[model samples]
Target: MALDRWIALVFVTFCCAYGYLAFATMDQLLPPFMQRNPVWPSTFPKVLAILGVIVGLVVLFGLEKPDSQSEPSATDINYRRLHEYKLGQALMLLGLMALYALSLRPMGFLLSTTVFLMAGSAILGERRWVIMFAVSAVAAGSVWYLVQQVLGIFLRPLPFFLGG
Candidate 1:
């Protein structure tokens, strides 16, 4: 009758249904060639469903004890002391990600990744711009080279103006 028990019951039901559907529709969802593989495409979903069922059973049975010391009291709740810097940094990082995604194809992987790393380091309070840029360049170039040359995975080419 407790909230945790109710949540667990719902979670178990959903996971069971999801697992059943995933297994039932595996053949239809996957290509014929893909179905030949030992690890089917539905494997991840089925695994997650099983894990979810286990977690739900644990929660429903109340296997874990609630820690009283970690619980916040009514008096301990203070809105004024909230850390703004952490929130601001998180928002900035998200914005940078969006910008990077938008510019990636046009700017190429190496250039976009370098800029993203430099911006992320600066936002995280790194002071030395020169060193940050150098590190960013090296890291980005290494990943690009490894993926393109060693792994044979081609990235988006640079724009025509930049000599793709």
Candidate 2:
């Protein structure tokens, strides 16, 4: 896992640098009136930079050092397996997101949303039909009610399934 450690360190470094840049660069061109907002525009990024710095330091110095005594063995999976697994997971997520987006238009709000929730649960390895159906139904109905009746926004109805 040396490579994973190195990758983690690099990611932390990038996050710290990115947050510093956001703090430094946000208001360079803004007018004085805009800068006087009740909240400092740089507040969130500064907090992020602080968090990133702490996390980076922890990763660089605090992790346990691997034992040096074990003999190398052939039972360990190689880097190729890691790469293939990551790629497969990425593709699955991409397909699920595509289905969610496509269904939103034609199927409208409720059914599309239910399918999206069910697909997400499936992707996460949930297989119990009763639980999947119950959770998806509740989630979709809640989102639909909150977005439509409570908020008073006429959501695109599930015209495809419920009929136009």
Q: Pick the candidate with the highest TM-score.
A: 1
- Please write out the lDDT profile of model 2 over residues 44-131, one tens digit for every residue: 8877877877776666673544567364345533564666455765688889998888878788888888888887878778999789
Instruction: Please write out the lDDT profile of model 1 over residues 75-109, one tens digit for every residue.
Output: 44244555733789989999999999998888999
lDDT of 1: 0.85
Identify the candidate with maximal lDDT: 1
Name the lDDT value of residue 94 in candidate 1.
100
- For each candidate, how many residue pairs have backbone atoms clashing (under 3 Å)? 0, 0
In terms of TM-score, how similar is model 1 to the real structure? 0.67
- Residue 97: error of model 1 in Å? 0.5
Q: Which stretches of candidate 1 lie over 4 Å from their true place?
A: 1-26, 31-37, 52-85
- TM-score for each predicted model, relative to the true structure: 0.67, 0.62
